[model samples]
Target: MSMSYIDKNYIYAVSRIRYAELRLLDGSVFDRLIEAKDVAECITILAEKGFGGEYRDPEGMLGYEKSRLWELIAELVPDMSVFDVFRLQNDYSNLKAAIKESALDLDIPGIYSQEAVADPMLIKQAVRERRYKELPLEMADIAELCHELFLRTGDGQLCDIMIDRAAMEAILRAAEASKEPVLIEYSRLTVGASDIKIAVRAMLTGKDDEFLRRALAPCPLLDTELLIRAALSGMDELCAYLMNTDFKDAVTELRKSLAAFEKYCDDLIIERLGTQKWNSFGLGPIAAYILARETEIRSVRILLTAKQNGFSAESIRERMRRTYV
Candidate 1:
């Protein structure tokens, strides 16, 4: 931790982010995106709003946007220490993408090929060369970890569970290491939401005990064994089990649709993160701000897709994540 926590550099960075956020429309942009009939029209509208990237090609736009934002974040926090919280997630995403390629018997490829890892051949060669040693410190064991996960989980829902569990564990551990109250709270809320989602899916599908166990993501708030047991028991049992948790409000809705429940959880996380960004100290505020921006971008994309697909306004609204700002 740097002793100069409230220096001019930090203040300047925060002010720039605040100004950038203010330039974004609250709900008006979302409304426009939801009404866009085609990709071109959506891109034109985005350009009009100062999101002037390569709109003729969506992939190029994604790359450009990701690069621009990441560059800004780097400039804001030159040491990259503040973004370490995301290292675990980046490692996990890279591994998952590799596993997906392996499962299909294709060469290891990056899912976000444009922004990072543009060449599939290069990724394959790196894995063949045991090049984990050449990667970032946090990513050193990621290749091996992904391989192990695939061997163990075999591309089933459990694969998702394993990766999410690892991510949650990392967040909790990092929170502990930093002794940041906001991080701890955020980790607990995220894990609790995840548990709720898992429980709902298990109860709805009548999955096996083994499956439930394999699908569970490890979190600080939930006793994994007890949660699996409750999920296997019944929906009523699962709901009862979550009596004291943060996601109790979601239980009733979860009974209807797991997808909806999951979306609700995501919106809640984004909202909470946005709120934290306003009051956070040290690097936490910057990290939270980045998450909020990423989340907003996702929301806009979702809206655009929905509109282009001809979904109704009510349907689009239903799918929109709650705005934290």
Candidate 2:
């Protein structure tokens, strides 16, 4: 095997990330996070751990914490220019908040704060003013699309589906553009896994075909109709449907518990990305390293929450994703 395809920069980037991952595994950080009573205390503790960033508000610290964590990692890796991806994910989340506010017709400040964008007011103004391109990422464009869907159907569910669909489309596009096998594989795996989750949830919820179509995200790997049909049938049928796909290895674990299955899938994806021997110069290795860190942070949060909530380690393990460990 000629390692000619490997980029030297990616290798260096991964090396740096491996060091950062070690820092995240520190027990003291988790102890501090677990000791925090409220969101403010958590933020303060995290700030002490070098999590510096301007959060939106006290109540929304959960989202702010995740957003800021990603931002810090982005700052660490200038080669990874996917701040827009994180911003857009936040925007999608914020758009959900915005629509909820619009539905309640309530006065909600810090709407933009929910979004990771620097000037959410500007993004909101852009959408309110109908500048879809100015939104943020391809996902932001989906949020804009959701606004139109909201106006047309008056169904919040449809708007949510539209945004999800747009995201799937964007990820598929990104996967296509990714020069490395790791990102392309990760993106495809993400789309497929997401479709499985949607199918399983739909089957459990007893939603109708129309709702399923409107609710399910459209991705390149799985056909929407197949998901709807499997969902309408049963879990066995759904599992059988996915068994032939690349994710068949997950079906056995998922059959035990949906939460476990989800965790398993996440670990698989993270492991797949983290193990790839990409060189450090390009966006590929950095993106993988960043996502890996985010996974570890979320895992720690889950552990802390579980400990605080009195959930057993077994129960917590069901929902825990694989980390650098």
Candidate 3:
């Protein structure tokens, strides 16, 4: 497609998103939130910022804000499937929840996420009935495999690993098929970072090479085989291997703790996507807005949780993600 055509197509959505981006919370807002004396104070800050309005509890507030975010996206974007790469993870999560709930014969409420490309209820029904035809081909196949694996082996971890790897693969495939640079870059970074986290955790827990191989998805930035080998060796070897990759900067955070490493990954994504703010037209800005809002909500959640748990302001600050504004 021509650049002009793509730009024209996304003009309205981008324009709307530009206005929406103005409401996004900045670093100072997050700082105030972190410094809040209590959860009530944190909620007051969020309310002033027009987030989680009238929802006193954190869970309800966050959930309402998330639904509002997607609702806005659905209103602005004509073709929702273009952003399926972002929502497919939620679909897979619901699939995982449904499969486990059905297998264990338990009624787990609020376990499914609302931001899915597919209907969570449909996924739950399909898994319950063993009706794979109801789901998308990619999800259907994995759902069947994971359902049977969970049933036969009773190993939730294995099932989770399978579904998680499949979710990453699906994301990569969607990014490629969309032919959008922003989506492609996001997918590459997301998968690469996930693989790194998996390697780090596996090495710490002494998981074998086979588990690492199975867990890590293929991304352009990182060599999966080398990562597997490095993970099998040790954290130092893995860190050394990572030093030669795009994630070298994250090595220091990785050495700190998993939470710090995750914060580093989120910050990297925000830094990369921040460039989209200058683009006058195209899906990039809209996508960036969506991610920015999500990041803001997550930072708020961290603050509220920390305040509720009586965590120190410095500790909460260390865990806060970078803002996109």
Cα lDDT of model 3 by residue, 1-325, tens digit: 6555644458878888888888888888888888889998888888898888678789989988998988999898767887898888898899999999999999889999878988899999999999999898898888999999999999999899889999999999998998878888888999999989988888888999889888888899999999999888888998999999999999999999988999999999889999999997778888888888888888888888889899999999998899998
Error of 2 at 247 (Å): 1.2
185 Cα displacement, candidate 1 (Å): 3.1
What shift in Å separates residue 230 of candidate 2 from its native position after superposition? 2.0
TM-score of 2: 0.75
Among all candidates shown, the one with the greatest TM-score: 3
Total clashes, candidate 2?
Answer: 9
lDDT of each: 0.65, 0.64, 0.89
- The candidate 1 region of ten consecutive residues with least summed lDDT is 112-121
Question: Where is model 1 more than 4 Å wrong at Cα?
Answer: 1-9, 52-54, 100-105, 108-126, 130-160, 276-281
Predicted candidate 1 versus true structure: per-residue lDDT over 35-149, tens digit per residue: 6666677788777776646555555565566667778888886666545454456555655566666555676333633333223344444555557565544444645666666
RMSD of each: 3.9, 5.6, 2.1
Q: Residue 62 lDDT in model 1?
A: 53
TM-score quality measure for candidate 3: 0.96
Please give the lDDT score at residue 104 for candidate 1.
57
Better candidate by TM-score, 2 or 3 = 3
**Count of clashes, each model:** 0, 9, 0
Task: At residue 280, give the lDDT of candidate 1.
Answer: 25
In angstroms, the error of model 3 at 126 is 0.8
